[model samples]
Target: MDAGAPSEGWPLDDRGVAYGDGLFETVLVRDGAPRLWEYHLARLARGCRVLGIPMPAEHELERPLAQAGEGVMVLKLIVTRGSGGRGYAPPAAPAPRLRWQLSPLVPDAARWKVGVRVRHCRLRLGLQPALAGLKHLNRLENVLARGEWSEADIAEGLLCDGEERLVEATCMNLFWQRGGRLETPRLDRCGVAGTLRAVLLERLPIAEVDAAPGVLAVAEAVWLGNSVQGLWPVARLDGAGGEALQRWTIGAVHRRLQAVAHEPLGYPTRLDD
Candidate 1:
């Protein structure tokens, strides 16, 4: 649990908790240290700028991270417009709330070995270019789709936009192997551009397209990515899947991603000098 106060406590009323007028970033921390800390902070700062809220320093969240205990972990940082009155008008002297949480992260064992099963969700995403790529708090759509499954076997669920085009998985970005190259949905109009997705595009040769819904069903293999999971393969698909959807279809990119996630410290410094 976070130790930060309710500088914008209830009765005070924060617009974020009240109206989902905020942004968040889930960072992947290993051991007692954070990975790509600056990158995650950069994105969070940008999100605050987008929503017109001032950014909080990383140390502001250090207390919660310390309380998080140990091992691989997830750190969530939420910043919202603090204490509003009645209307949507900004507070005369707004106090932005910085709520943070850190907790142990133990991914399903199967994910590391065999990947996980997934299905196409019925809930379609709404197109909102303004908020398409940012990690905002108004995620009723993701929550609804994620709630569609109760069983633990269902590792993730794919989502289509209002036009029935593949956008992404519930909380991760999607990537498909077409026997030659990698293809993924463009998040310009919908979906969150994941941190791992940014790394892949910046590091590998990939494609950004408005993938048709059937691509997941027809692709040779599929995978999903986020900062935490890196890139985990999709072992099985329950739909009009491709040619029986070859089992354990681990592509080159999949292996590369796994290596990056598990051994980020040993990774070669490929960033241009």
Candidate 2:
């Protein structure tokens, strides 16, 4: 593995840059060890198989991760089908390129403890089952949704699909409690299957369903989560016009799941006042 500078130049015709033909993973590193390492690799491998890109050996990826040293940081790994092809068609034999960069991570302690404010996005995600769960390079939809809000207090925007089914947040998977049951959107048709969501699915009894946005209004509680931020309880949900649509109080359920994520992701545990 090469610890080359992230500023190094790549060919302009690289498939990842030309047509967004690539996969990437954002890993959280703490004290020189990456959290959810296997899960991240598994997701990357799945994406490579789907995109027909070659998957590099685990040892090659581990060297960069081990160099994170002490303190918290984020490591972004990108794998692309190296430059060379005819028009839109890929080359007969593709050589994959692997690049990784590490940077310091600052924890959001206040948001984790007091919860965050979120709003529904007007932009809807288009369905593509083939690329549904992979964190591929194409992210225009998320970029647009995130741009919908510029308020410093609004932490995230909830995205739904064209079919009116709530999908996920701009950058995280969403979960809510309603009717005495824990439910999350079904990502089979669209949305990124976040690593932390994968971990909770294995350890908890949450159900995946195709539900409408109205469910959130009646939900007992709502939360948005990802590998890097762990879990953030949703204190309020607003509409595009800034109308309060739903609200939740930070409670036991939030702390319970925080405890579950704390072990793997190192999120700080907080007690209810």
Q: Could you tell me how far off, in angstroms, the CA of residue 139 lies in candidate 2 after the best superposition?
A: 0.5
| Candidate 2: C-alpha lDDT | 0.88
List runs of model 1 lying over 4 Å from the truth. Answer: 1-12, 240-248, 251-253, 265-273
The lowest-lDDT stretch of 10 consecutive residues in candidate 1 is: 264-273
Q: Mind sharing the TM-score for model 2?
A: 0.96
lDDT, candidates in the order shown:
0.73, 0.88
Model 2, clash count?
0
lDDT of 2 by residue, 103-212 (tens): 99997888888899999999999999999999999999999999998999999999999999999999999999888788999998999999999998999889999999
TM-score of each: 0.85, 0.96
Q: Identify the candidate with maximal TM-score.
A: 2
| Candidate 1 per-residue C-alpha lDDT over 117-139 given as tens digits, one digit per residue, 9 for 90 to 100 | 88778888999988878898999
